[model samples]
Target: MKTGGVLLQQKTKKNINITIRNLTISDITHQYCNWLNDKETNKYLESRFTEWNMQSLLDYYHQKNKSELMLAIIEDDTGTHVGNVKVSAIDKNHHRAEIGIIIGDKNLWGKGIATTAIGIVAEYCFDVLDIHKLTAGAYAENLASINAFISNGFIVEGQRKEHVLTPSGWSDVVLLGKIKSQE
Candidate 1:
């Protein structure tokens, strides 16, 4: 599904306006690649395990775009490509999908951009894609990520203790889920 135009918009708690659109290959820039390579930016992300470059990022975008709904989060006032939100692992038979997000711009962290982006993508998954359930997982220590999902109505479904190995030590994986209301 190509979401080229403005899919949704929301003013973050910081009053920063943002919108999301499908992430095209053209959106994969050197700066975008750098985000994946940044230590702080990818700390909780599996991408931190890999050294990313332009070609690698482009290949990833091409691969994911084939099966997932990848979107770019844009800062409206500046029109900056600040981040990405992805709806992946779509199980059509079960009407469920996994949602993942990364606010690449460190400057925008804690600005409610992630929360607003998750809310927009969750709505698209339920209303546009006809998905009944949306799920996400975050590193136990990543409170910002967990809170972002929670702010969008995702509930804590379960936790897998010491599920992932981090630089510091093993960390739990917090699983969260949200089911569409039966209106």
Candidate 2:
């Protein structure tokens, strides 16, 4: 598991300063577990299928920390852990990876935190990790997530019709991608 160290920082348009850091086991708490189990928060997330408890969450953290970059989004002003951004499915030989994000704090929604976090992490993937391409997918109804990636220069690459099963029935998935600038 990666130690908890601030990896990136940026200021959102709303003037909220946030930082991204390697998530540690200690970061897992009852509140964090609640965020995952919350219906509205995890609606578009695959994790919604599973019930999340502290033990299960810890197990997940252990598994993901091994192969992917699991980052925590922290509100710098109040020093609170607000959410997470994951860079997973990393194909080193192909220089590509998939990015996923969740802003668990409902009160913090629509504050440009997702957009800013995605931007910072995308920069790290391209410049620091030497990843050539980054991809993300969102449920068709998840305009907030799609727009967040779009705001950071990701283009909608394609859409998979009826790609995922949801509570409301099958839903389309919007695929978005961004290539590292050559310059």
Which candidate leads the pack in TM-score?
2
Instruction: Give me the runs in candidate 2 sitting further than 4 Å from their true place.
Output: 1-6
TM match of model 1 to true structure = 0.96
- Model 2 scores a TM of 0.96
| Per-candidate RMSD, Å | 1.5, 2.0
Residue lDDT tens for model 2, 1-183: 122345799999999999999998888998899999999999999989889999999999999998989999999999999999999999978999999999999999999999999999998888788899999999999999999999999999999999999999999999999999998
Quantify how close model 2 is to the true structure by its C-alpha RMSD in Å: 2.0
**Best model number under lDDT:** 2
Q: Provide the TM-score for each candidate, comma-separated.
A: 0.96, 0.96
Lowest-sum lDDT 10-residue window in model 1: 1-10
Residues 82-102, candidate 1, lDDT per residue (tens digit)?
999988998878999999999
What are the runs in model 1 whose C-alpha is more than 4 Å off? 1-6
Clashing pairs in 1: none
**Whole-model lDDT, model 1:** 0.90
